[model samples]
Target: MKQAFLTALVCSTICSLGAPLKVKGLRTESATNPIGVSNSPRLSWQLDSEERGNFQRAYEILAATTQEKLDEEKADLWATKKQQGAAKLLVSWQGKPLKKGQKVHWKVRVWDKQDRPSGWSKIATFVVGEQAKLLKPGRISGFESSSEKLNQLYRQSIANLEKRLDAFTEGDVAALGDGSAVHRSARAFLYHFDSVPHLTEWLRLMDSEITKDNFFPIYPGAQTTAPVSSDSGVLVTHPLWWMSGDAQPTRSRWDAYEGHIIAREAQDTLLKGTKWGGIADSENVAAEFIDLCYLGFSCRLILELALPAVQPQKAIRFQVYASRIRKSFERQFVNKDGSLKSKSQTGHVLALRSAVLNPEQKAKVLADLIALVTKNGSKVGPIGAHFLPGVLSLTGNQDLALKSLTSLNAEEQKNYTESGIAEWLMTFVAGIDTIAPGFNQVIISPRIPSNDSLSWVRAYHDSPTGQISVYWKKLSPDSALKAEVMIPTGALSRVILPIRKNQKITESGNEIADAKGVEIIERKDGKVSLITQSGKYSFLIK
Candidate 1:
């Protein structure tokens, strides 16, 4: 009896040595510690203990949308009810759909091998940082100029963009799910082609789509389905891809004169003459011009967007090809008088964007194009409908860009057009241009457009460096513009804000009279420029 009692005591002591099972480390999908963007993110946790043989037999995970719910032990969002398994990685979330930017609070408890239940682990938290939508703008509220009405409109626009980008998926972009092949392709260029923060990933997505269509020449040859020239080096309009195979059968038969020409041949021919006509089956003259301009843009994209990010050796051959196409575009499209042969919006935009003209020529062309668009009373074509605003902004025509975006009524804001507005606001208006390869450096130059009513503007961008924000307010027409900028970590910036002659500039409420790491770069075209390191800066353009 005494031995039995001693044995029971010893067993009890040994049981006490087996510490309770506890979850020590927790992580979301892709091992994102605190920031996660996946809507249906998988959760994983490591069951830990000091005692030997204390393995996890089962686990119960609880996730809450709010910290309050989590603290109160209310798993209102998601709860894995006593899942019996050793699977600790990528445990799927069978719960309510996660909204963009939702913060999730989660904790887990486990049952040990001996069936002893452990207490809930410390409540860990993660923020849903990766939203499928455009980065949200910072809040701006005050009783100033047109606050209630304009603010509401801005919010609505942001909400719409969020919804649209959230729904935009890889499949949506690749298979022309959103529209026809041309439309989807244009949308891809507008949204993510050259300027997305994730440059490499964007290129991958674009390359996949282009490769799928066999990288058909811009113009398809006599054979509508078969390319008379399968060589990508040659520039042809593949009709099926161009118009979604909608051209009447008759047009295709007569336009076989210039069926397929190698890049070299096209370049030489274009340099000699201005007649860059399409095949018989091709679209109208203006449409053909637009198609050719897009072809040039595509080739330029290969150089500008894909070249630096890809292997240098792999890109060298394409680099040569792209340069020839650009030069050909310069020779074929633009007249000696800095006027486009097509005299269309697409022609003007592509000419300005391709940088094929000399400085004097560019200035003349910009003035003429501006006059053309303004004279046309904003009658932008389909291709122009997408790229015109961005081109205007790029050419230092912000007021016109604003007019292009806002002149369209609420009902007319479709066809991926608002993306241009967003781009202008976030990039040109806010003045956040990525200078380095991956936002390593930035040029933050905010300008007040001619729209006098826009007394204040605030914009944000999620660059590769991090979140960059710019806000500016014109206290009065004659008063200087007050601008605030938040530069992301690991980025240097050159800030250029509008200022009148003899006006002073202040950073963070202190006159930058003797600031270090800050110097006047130049005063050009009514804007004062300063180079600065990364930090939050507030400038009074007095």
Candidate 2:
């Protein structure tokens, strides 16, 4: 009897310890703007955790939509673990790119290494907006912002974006789904083009179906095929949207153009000096122009990242990008109200992208572009519909950007809510604070700044590799304040400490990364410091 009792006790203890990790302390301190909101509607959660690590974890983040069968991999919509820390988890809910308005219930779940789940978190519902926020004398932030924390947050945040991109490249519906022309995704840019004939045919069809360059690209409302017996059509719960790769019947024709010269020959022969004019020669079509511009943008970045260039002739392609955008800018776009229909008109007056033009001309061209978008934006607006200007602008008030949106009627909001766009602007202002001294303020700690009873708590474990870090770039006009760094010890395998300056983070341990996962404390004395396992490196904040 004694031996049986001891065995039973041991079994019970092990089962309790090995139970699937539970998620508690569920509170949303802040809902930063959903990512790629204008193009891809999403929800972001900033929650403070009282629970520690469950060590090796797997998360199930999904959007509960009208559809019963929710396949994230098929849908192309995905969730990512973002803003990870010792005591907080910022899980962003990203819905797939969808047609006008689709409501969704998004939530997340975490699983331990043992494959048992702690259950899903609360679902936050939101609608996808066709247009992101346009400047309306309001500040814009988020892209390549200067805030150190925001930048660091990008490390975690972009992981999600990278995965999102890969979904499209890997031939998924979510990635292949596109709702417009002017707002083509990175996925659209890489649409299957193995042959020139196929590419040409596809572009022609795309021009009519969804190119913003042609006109308002979205389908007229009520034209979509709703699910049977349901008034509410299919909802976009995943990021990868409805993709059926059969759109291009002859996509294989472009394979012959692989020799570099074929692409060039097509550019010069079919397009140059004739009605089908080449990109550099000023007669380039808007679709072609955007395509080359994106290609060139990609090339520049790949070269910068030290990735080998597949086609060495990309340098020449760069020369063609300007002609595309410039010609489109100069062309008389079909206007809803006689507005210049080009990205330059939407903004982009100061792209330090190329050193080809003289400073005066470059500035003048950029200004002209901004002026076009700012002046006549009201006629054909919701700038994000066009993609360029709505995102690129960041400053004091988005008054101009807002104007570009052409106010949406209540009916329109049903399909095009600015919920995420509004938050993106908040992040936008924070970004400005990091660039210009008086641009805006960036809030570091208290990301979800709240006095609510909604917070949750969880358990944690210890590992040398598991760590956390919190960063802040002087957001206030004054110097750094006494910020408290909170880390959930349960999730950490190991802890390290270090400080970052001018975007450079330095670590301590030689054998191990000192406080690599540790947090930061930037004090008023112009010194920055952090606690590592062994010691702390302190520097006064300026």
Candidate 3:
């Protein structure tokens, strides 16, 4: 009897200890109940257990438009019935197509290694966004390059940015000091991939934070008296307006902030003069570089705004204020030999990008920048790092840019924002850029390195109109170059092909001039520029 009782107690204890795993931390698209989720959202959840060696062997997910349906296991939306895999993250939504503004309720259950099933997790929900249709299964922008390291970096950067989107709050992005700046800097790249609804939502939140004093906080929702950088508001609003072609939201905010900007300009208080002219943030050299860049960028934007007849005088006056800041910058920062007084990489990059340097100064600055990057290898802080790769490519040092980019260690790469890396790869490496807002017109000028370090590249971006793709490769070690381009319907592209001495260009066995949907715009400076309508075209330069 005693032996039997002992045996029964052991059996009961074993059964009790082997309870099912509990599910928690349910997420969709790396967010907890996110608003504006993608149509085909990625689902994820965490597993909890007390037993040692407990591991998930399989999972089941049920999604519905209503909680009642999900509770009844109706799965009116999607049901992954007994999926056999260890994958618990980013499981693609395979149910019905999610509509805009529709709330999707989803829950999950997992089986342990011993095949014991867990209870269904609490149902989580995510609302579909208007632009959710733009997101595809994998990456928004397709990228592959000669260097596998760069290709991996491209993928990792895109993933990081998607994850960062989860940090969006009611009033701030990531709730960091430079959250607005990140949003502003990321606008163009996001638009390149046709990802804009989240940015639009962020802009709306920022607009609401603008007080009657016309003061936008440097850190939204933070207790601080410091004013935002001069260009923050316009930088975010103007590009969003151009990309989305939605005028009302941008126009209304512009109208509200215009008076404050003008008042500051009139008072010459847009920035404060320090050893470095008009340092917007006195925190560090990185912050100072960012501030100066913003001032210069804001000036350029005002000049662009002045080109139109609407409020020309105000725009002109702003330009004048901008000129004063430019002169101050040049006087304080540029040395006699055109070298920067400070040997900071961020400062050099921003100086070139902000249009503060004259042609001669720019040439000298470019040389200096190359030398600096070669020595340090992208040692800038978060803010400065954003502009480094793009600037390096723009100055015809793609080799150096690639070197700096691929040389980043895992931790160093993590420190850099996804926007900078993605923008550089898409805009410079693949060379697909917008000549007009909303990608109505594009420029396909792939910059191949003169050296053998990089041999081929292929990339595509889904624009608002349609998908624009480009692929280019060298036919031989020192021979001809071949390029393939895809222009979407209702869009125009300017395809620029580099020409070497004694090389002839042809399209599909004929001269490029005779190709359909192709119009030669100009042949200058060793490049033949052709305007192409929506179609695929292959070119050979030999």
Please tell me which predicted candidate would have the highest lDDT against the true structure.
Answer: 3
Arranged by TM-score with the best first, the candidates are: 3, 1, 2
**What are the Cα lDDT values of the candidates?**
0.53, 0.31, 0.68
Ten consecutive residues with minimal summed lDDT in candidate 2? 229-238
Candidate 2 segments exceeding 4 Å error? 1-265, 269-359, 369-384, 388-399, 402-542
Q: What lDDT score goes with residue 216 in model 3?
A: 53
lDDT per residue for candidate 1 within 1-542, as digits (tens), equals: 99999999999997766767767556564233445446777665655554533456888989998878988989998888898876565577788887767888999988877778999988877666663332222222111223333344345544544444443433233221222223223322222322221221222333233323233332212122222112222211221112111122113311221122233244434433222323221212343344444444444443432222333454455456556655665676667776666666555665666445567767877788799777753545333545576778766777776665555555445433433334444555556666654354678876567557467776665443345677888877567778887665335788888877878888767767665446687887788888876557778877
Error of 1 at 472 (Å): 0.4
Report clashes for each candidate as comma-separated counts.
Answer: 13, 77, 0
- Which tens-of-lDDT digit does each residue in 1-542 have in candidate 3? 99999999999998866677778767665456777776877776766655433567889999898999998999998888998876664577889988889998889998987888999999998999853322222235788888988788777766666555544533235432344455435653473343455565555555567655565545445333232342455566666655544444544565645654664454446454322323354324544445555566666765554433255666766667677777767777789888788777877877787767788888898888899889879877665677788787776777888888778887768656454577777888898888876566788998788777788999888665446789999888557999998875445689987887788888877886677668788887888888887667888999
lDDT tens digits, residues 142-177, model 2? 222333333333333333333433453343423323
> Model 3 off-target regions past 4 Å?
1-139, 167-177, 188-194, 225-231, 263-271, 274-290, 305-309, 417-419
Model 1 lDDT, residue 296, Cα? 49
> Better model by TM-score, 1 or 2?
1
Of 1 and 3, the candidate ahead on TM-score is: 3
Q: Is candidate 1 or candidate 3 better by lDDT?
A: 3
TM-score of each: 0.56, 0.31, 0.69
